[model samples]
Target: MSSRFKMSDLGLLCFYLGIEVQQGHDGIKLLQSAYARKILERAGMGSCNPCHTPMEHRLKLSKASTTAPVDATKYRGLVGCLRYLVHTRPNISFAIGYVSRFMEQPIVEHLNAVKRILRYIAGTLDYGCHYKHGG
Candidate 1:
């Protein structure tokens, strides 16, 4: 490609966007602990208790469900950050997607759901995808 456009070597990629890349004999491991922690901090859940799962199993959310309303802007912002986080943490994809549906008119229940996700993230900060050389 050097023959086409001018480009210089930026050295081995250790970080890109918010993902952290680690190289070793076994394989390459991608992490996003920093990004996850920042999300928790932004949501004011930095010291929150960790949870086993991203969201409660069998949890169902509906717009018609009566509940106190929450700040739509804040709720949407959290969901947006979670969406970006899905790039390296697919485990929370479903949970984030489920809670995102209420961004237009998020309620207290939805906010709680979002907080649960943050708690789950706190427990799994080191969790990420590892691409083995051969598996």
Candidate 2:
């Protein structure tokens, strides 16, 4: 397209929408360390220590138990935002999908679960999907 029309070369892509894009010898890697940090700071949990896992495997979420309700819009928004992230973040897909099931009427417990995910992100800022060049 650049040959057809007059356009400036921008060089290699580095960042887009807070996501870091880097080309390596093997392939290209997509990461969102900046976005993860912003999420921690926005939630005022930046100082909180990181955890190995987002949530325990035994953590069970049931619709029967109605713990105090929180902001539906905010919770849903978070879930929706995370969904976009799952494109290059398959590791968190299971957890995020589980929590998203209750977006319509999220409770305090559900909110806490979401916070845990943020905490997990803090620890795994370097985590991302890597695609090989020849793959």
How high is each candidate's TM-score? Answer: 0.92, 0.88
Q: Judging by TM-score against the true structure, name the best candidate.
A: 1
Q: What is the C-alpha lDDT of each candidate?
A: 0.92, 0.83
Q: Per-residue CA lDDT of candidate 2, range 1-135, in tens? A: 978999998899999876799887999999987777766776777878888897878999976675799999988877776777776678999999999999888899898998888878788988998989876
Give the runs in model 1 whose Cα sits over 4 Å from its true position. Answer: 1-8
Q: Residue 15 error for model 2, in Å?
A: 1.6
lDDT for model 1 comes to 0.92
Cα lDDT tens digits for candidate 1, 88-134? 89999999999989999999999999999999999999999989998
What TM-score number comes out for model 1?
Answer: 0.92
